[model samples]
Target: MGKKNVSGWSTIIMLLTAAALFTGCSASAGSKPSAELHEKTMHWDKMPEMTIDLDKSYTAKFTTSMGDFTVKLYAEDSPITVNNFVFLAKQGFYDGLTFHRIMETFMIQGGDPKGNGTGTPGYSIPDELDTELKYEPGIVAMANTGKPNSGGSQFFISTGKDSENLNQMPNYTIFGKVTEGMDTVLAIAKTPVKETKPIEPVIIEKVVIVQS
Candidate 1:
């Protein structure tokens, strides 16, 4: 839960510094992967317990109603997440998705099928916690509940200032942060919420990869 409007002055100095620190939490989508289509295409039981392949960087744009937000990933810093996100993104898994939950000052969490905040990509990644990064505002990280390695498809985008005590927790790998469209993020966060769910769903219509 958060209070008041969370405002962050986008200092050019801070932006440069932030670019040096963030890692890959991951993202997905290109084609419309229908629920029925995915069920037939992917086999949960046969899928490798750990199917993420690192050694790559992924850039994708989030096409939302508010605007488009782009994210860049770092596999070197968060290998497990990088692999996972790339795999899912290539599979077009995040299409037609909703940003299920959006809190005010606190981070907005998504990627759950339950919409109660307890869904995953059918597996979890080990924590790739590094001492360099903290839960700074605009910093993106995975959202986990129990244990250190229980993270999967869920993630959160920070709202206000840096988190005061999140760095103390072990695991919970941070994979990426917002590169542009912080205003859109703030607008999304400011959307009304009830019981942790947004009053008007912020749908990610599609994701497009932007090559360098």
Candidate 2:
């Protein structure tokens, strides 16, 4: 299926504005005093040791609270990103984490241990961007801070036509694309959010990876 047309430049602009506003709200929440206290109360140093065979194909089956979906990792196009994601999945790093950032007609982001956008995997990985990979809906990619090779465990799934523009900016690492259960993804995307965060937590039950 093709991406839905978002009307025109004006609608696209409005979507972009909403996205920006959501990001800003998330940022502000992370910086709040209560959020700082929450950070201090919780230990964020847990990182798993993992390994991956770069020679094989990997597919991740995500069983989420909303439903199940599968993404096929592009090992050849994004070796490092795929490897890291596979490793994390095997280690159950994504279990119970909430999709914290949800912008309708944009993307749903998660994989942060903190359930906040600011959390990381205690380290960053180098970017593996492929010019050939466009950010179409169902494209799974790493989320970064616009800095070089700063991707961690945080990632997002493209949900709208605007992702085509995201393809133009090659900052985020494109690692995989959802091959099944996109209907579940779209359902999750329609969830209501306040300050870019889902009003109710959408939990990731587990991530199961299979090698081929």
Candidate 3:
């Protein structure tokens, strides 16, 4: 009787082990691919040809390591900036890029190909600033070198409501705003950082453009 009991317990243990292995394999197969698997970064000789229809409304959905956020593009108000952004988003230029700068309670900046403060898309676009737009929280704007017509691929999203400081320096082009998932943007803003850079990488996994 004792021998039979021992044999039954051994069978139970083997079945449990097999189940665990199968679960592990399934999870591994279904998981999203790591950022390293994507090779979408490339330099363009000039700005991409404008293909966005001004009449249609557009939005960009960014999938990141922390979470997802959606930005509504102000195409009519900032056509050039919106067009360039849309082109890059469709081309997958922003994928796998890290959010290099983070100013707590202020903003989070990304879209730099170099994953640092000094990368551009091999070209620059003229600033498309509107006097009416305010640099309030959830506002998305282009990052530039504090020079005229120096706007490029880098962009930032405002996380704080206090814009008296940004309003004073009114250079970042206001092309979009976070229409959904501001929580994700704030979450990223709260990431631990050193020297204004996130200690651990917060990658832009992908950016999907939606036109209506």
Best by lDDT: 3
Task: Please give the lDDT score for candidate 1.
Answer: 0.60
By TM-score: ranked, best first: 2, 3, 1
* Of candidates 3 and 1, the better by lDDT: 3
Give the per-residue Cα lDDT of candidate 1 at 175.
Answer: 84
**CA RMSD (A), model 1:** 9.9
Model 3 off-target regions past 4 Å? 1-41
Residues 92-207 of candidate 2 have per-residue lDDT tens digits of 78887878788878788888666756666666788777458878899988887666776778888988886666643456788999999999999999998997778888888899
Which tens-of-lDDT digit does each residue in 51-150 have in candidate 3?
8999899999999999999999999889999999999888889988878788766778888776645566777888877547878899888877656787
- Candidate 1's TM-score reads 0.72
Clashing pairs in 2: none
RMSD per candidate (Å) reads 9.9, 5.3, 20.8
* Preferred candidate (TM-score higher): 1 or 3: 3
Better of 2 and 3 by lDDT: 3
Give all candidates' CA lDDT scores: 0.60, 0.74, 0.75
Model 2 bad stretches (over 4 Å): 1-50
> Between prediction 1 and prediction 2, which has the larger lDDT?
2
